[model samples]
Target: MKYYIGLDIGGTTIKCGLVDETGKIIEKDSVKTSIKGEEILQNIETIVSQFKSEKPITAIGVSAPGIVQKDGFMTTGGAIKDFFGINLKEEIEKRTDIKTTVENDANAAAFAEQWKGNAIGFHNYYCMVVGTGIGGGLIINDQIYRGGHGMAGELGMMSVMNVDNDQHLELNSLSFTGATVFGLLNYYNHHSDKPEVTDARVIYELADKKDKLALESLDFFYTALAKGIINLMVALDPEIVLIGGGISANSQFMEGLQAKIADLKSRNSDVRDLTFAEVKPAKLRNDAGIIGAVYRAIQAN
Candidate 1:
């Protein structure tokens, strides 16, 4: 039985796990992602050793937040500045003397969904995660399709506005967390004259309680999110568009979103088969990235 390691290197923590070809996380572990590459590499090496103590590992796979190149290099992203221009593949190999591969966390999550999660057997689809930030993955013909420069799935930053538009609104302004924060703080500023309320959790808690301002915040989030999904669908025309993230866990939001999408589609009957991307919760949730990372490693070999 060939064993593999999946490493999810997020901005805050590194989730490492051992798995077989079946995608079950056998032995899981994690560590902090340090600023120094040497220190981070050492942590990865230790995890590999720990996993290897019981299982005979054949390869390693890594999932990080960036555009992963085919040349075993991950591009630096907006959130994690420490990984910029770093040859993470080389560093891990140097530490463990084992070959490995890396991919974008979004892409990894999408792959896991397609391979073993909710979006399985779908020929063409996109996966979006509206968590701390907005991002997603693309799959075509049952495979992760990283277009042109392996950055095709960076949907959040792709044309939130039109050309020659002076007062264009970038989509991030309406991100899941951003919308909630804006509404809360905007309300507080106008009402109580406070500083800011940036946490989405507060928005969730308040909304659950049916707070007037928090309800408005939830509307802001769902509206933008529903609009984003509709726009993505018009472009990609995928059969299924899986939605994930912390906020996606809310059933109320999901049902409301489906209604919003249906209403939007009803307004445009002439446009193709009027269908919205089915919004479903992520199956593996947080573990999808690490499992997908392991899948990539074994496939690369």
Candidate 2:
């Protein structure tokens, strides 16, 4: 019986797990992510060493927050400054003498869904993670598409709004600014005098209570997100768009987003393309990255 090490590296923590071939996590734990690259690598090595002491590990799979190439070369570290332009696969393999695989965090989540979660058996889909910003992954024809430079799934960078000549206009138009929790908070704090909501859930709660300001903020967010979804549908015509993130857990938000999309399509005949794509919440939740990393390692082996 062979086991693999799965690591999901985030800005705040590094989640490590020992996974079997069938995606079962035998043991899992996490450590704080080090600000320095070398210390982070050491932490991973410690975890791997501990896991190896108990089992016969065959390979490792890492999910990182950045522009990770198929070969595990990170072009830009999303939040970890020290990881920029580093070849994570080579580093880990050299240190552990085990086969290693790496993938972008969002791509890992998408792959996990296709392999064992919501999108199981689906051939074409897009996975969008709405965290502080938006991150996206494409699974087309049953394969992950990383684009030419392994940076294709940057859906957040897409511009959804057009405004007059103002420096703030460009930032406001970005999908990241329009659709994410951080964006919602920014909008709520800047536009309304309702004590400055901190969490996105607070806005949702207020909207549920029929607070006008909260309702308006959510309306703006849903509208922007609906526009982005329509644009994706028009471009790729994917079978489904899986929404991933903490906010996706909100049934009201998902329902509202779907309703808004329907409403937008009905109003604009040109966006008839939206009907071709379905929107649903992702199923894997927090474990998606770990499971997907194991799957990637399995494939590499």
User: Which candidate number has the best TM-score?
Assistant: 2
Off by over 4 Å in 2: 168-170, 173-175, 192-197
The per-model lDDT (C-alpha) reads 0.73, 0.85
Which ranges of candidate 1 are over 4 A from the true structure? 159-199, 267-273
Q: What TM-score would every model get versus the actual structure?
A: 0.85, 0.92
Total clashing pairs in model 2: 0
Q: Give the per-residue lDDT digits (tens) of candidate 1, residues 75-144.
A: 7644666677777788788788888888888888888887688887788988886655667898888888
Show the lowest summed lDDT stretch of 10 residues, model 2.
173-182
Worst 10 residues of 1 by lDDT: 176-185
Task: Report the C-alpha displacement of residue 238, candidate 2, in angstroms.
Answer: 0.5
